[model samples]
Target: MRWTKYWWLVMAVMLISTFAVFAVHDEAKGPEKFGRYEFKEQDKKAATDECDAGGKPGPEFVPTVRDKEPNLALLKDAKPEASSQLEGWCPRRHCVEYLNDGFYNNCRSWIIGAIPGWAQIDIGDVANVNRIYFGSDHSQGFLDRTTADFDILVATSKADPNSDANTWTKVYTHKGDPISETTEFTFKDVEARWLRLHIRTNGGARVDEIEIYGGKDPMDVEPSGKATTTWGEIKTE
Candidate 1:
């Protein structure tokens, strides 16, 4: 009588246990499986992109001649003196000497009445010269004087500023104009070991400072001050 009652319960338990084993076997999946779905090509590509390296920026150019490069004139010894002078009211002696002394002040400048004065500096080695700048001597305190007409010359060897005018290449010539500030003159780059400034005085000729640019002479360079990048600058594309 008891066997008849227990037979249905044993059959039901065996069927339920077999169904649970089949459900677990279907649920087991590989690492490539997703939630309720097998990974497709698009999903695989997205996963690969997420793990890929970030994008980078292209290279940029930076110019070195922005400001006046360190004066190579300071590196060597070259006497700056007037080549020759005639008897005149204005003091032309040591005129170029004070001008090339590397000091820019109102107290010292070269002045001549009407005679054209020339000053030369031997750079001691061949150099690439591209530009020249001269400071105006019309500062207060000196007698009333007009600006001086000037010409810039360059040469590959030491040449007499007075005798070898034909041997040097003339780069720039300036008409007599009133100048009270820094005046800049640009020229094609030339190889030169000698730099000369020839001045023709108007009412009076004055030179407060002389600056030459673009020389093959080695220059002291400072480290680049570039901005830093952060996570925001990074990209995936």
Candidate 2:
């Protein structure tokens, strides 16, 4: 009878401990929404009221790239396209053109409409790349629209302008919490003129910036958008 009592006591303690851990985690994440505007934590704040009013970016709203290396995805000639974007709701604020603009304001991010949509960048030339960065709006607030599960893909050439099909190779796959801040993914050097952020699952996903980095001269090729380029962008209306 005494042994049975001790077993029950141990089970009760384990259950209580598990619930306590989950409670702490939920508290750290904070609330998800604030007066219809999604809530995102930056520098560990409960909420940023300026973002609710559509205010300008603050001093902490710096570019995600902290190093001297140029963001190849931000080349002047680089072109971006997406499968679908949130239209009519916010006018030109949520267009795919803002995907690689090297900015982080809430108004400058792309809100993709499709759950499995893709945002692609053509660097305008074949470049050797090994690293990529993805981020949501740190200036305003991040919604559940921030990508949850996605893949980073690269292609040397494309058979169709509107279709990814079988032309691309996956470099990295992320399947966890939604990306609400700048995150980096690195792999072995791969040569390509096209880089794509493929979203698998999300809640009206938002993509603020996607930065591709290739170090040195031989590894990084400055794009010219010459006739020799393999892929042509599908114009987004």
Best by TM-score: 2
Q: What are the C-alpha RMSDs, in order, of all predicted structures?
A: 34.3, 12.5
Provide the TM-score for each candidate, comma-separated: 0.53, 0.64
Residue 155 lDDT in candidate 1: 66
- lDDT by residue (1-237, candidate 1, tens digit) is 689779988999998975553221111112322222121111323322332112211111111222534333333354555655334322322254544444332333455434566766665565566665555432222324545466677766457647345567776666645555445666665666677777766555566555555643322223222212111111110
Per-candidate count of clashing residue pairs (backbone under 3 Å): 1, 0
Cα lDDT of model 2 by residue, 101-190, tens digit: 545545667888867778989877778877777766554343446776777778877724444466777766777777766667776566
List residue ranges in candidate 1 displaced over 4 A. Answer: 1-68, 84-94, 138-143, 215-237
**Weakest 10 consecutive residues, lDDT, candidate 1?**
228-237
Q: What C-alpha lDDT values do all the predictions have?
A: 0.46, 0.60
Tell me the lDDT of model 2 at 21. 36
Question: What's the residue-level lDDT of 156 in candidate 1?
Answer: 64
Q: lDDT for model 1, please.
A: 0.46
